[model samples]
Target: MAFRLRASLERRHLAIDIVSAIVGHVAKADRNFRHELITAFGEAFNNIVIHGYRDRTDGMLDVEAEFSTEQITLRLSDTGHEVDFAGLKPPDLDSLPEGGMGVFMIHALVDEVVYHSGTPNVLSLTKRTAAASENDGH
Candidate 1:
């Protein structure tokens, strides 16, 4: 299944809620998987709004979600300032920085993270569902 959402930064919650609802329906039996996916997605969305657009309310976010029986993938695209994803460094866990953990948390929670910087920057996150993990004898 696939779903798409286009929303302004001002009304970001609506987009998040709608996507969360879709995730809930698709991953009903796996609470942990649902939480991880949502959390990772939220972090990515926040980064786009906060860093990519620099908190500009007029900025827009284009989100696409795809689901299979064993995995879920989310792609977020924004026409904001391009990000130097290659230059991003993981947060220092020992120091526990106050506000720079979004990227770190996103990478930790999702199985895959891919970013492409361009006119419309894109960030893609994918994770295997619990069923997939169990099926693989993990």
Candidate 2:
């Protein structure tokens, strides 16, 4: 009941294809994915490409997506310079900043995001079903 895909950061464009494939598989398990989630997945991929590999070199980006009964988790790992999360601040979206919005977008769109540091920075983005949340309200 587990599926996986991996690729290099050097060919970051391939991330989109992997995302789509994961989305379809996750949808099969839980039939309630919103367009917002789709957009968030795209942003998450971009985050790894930019933040995780923003240097003059080639590296590897490893992504593993897990779908459970109630949620889907995406783990993006990169072998680039370690990210210093201590200095992260929300960008001003009103002024139409050209960059630095991906993390904010991912935070706002996904239900949960967790980062674990090691040789490669690993970020896990989890999304809960709205249907499940609505059921909890009752």
Whole-model lDDT values for every prediction: 0.74, 0.63
lDDT by residue for model 1 (49-110), tens: 77788845677777777877678788888888875544268877799679787777788888
**Top lDDT prediction, candidate number:** 1
Model 2 clashing-pair count: 0
For candidate 2, list the clashing residue pairs, or say none. Answer: none
lDDT by residue for model 2 (1-138), tens: 223333334454466555656666553334336455666766765655566566634565667777755567877776666654332688887899997776777777777778777777887877877655676682
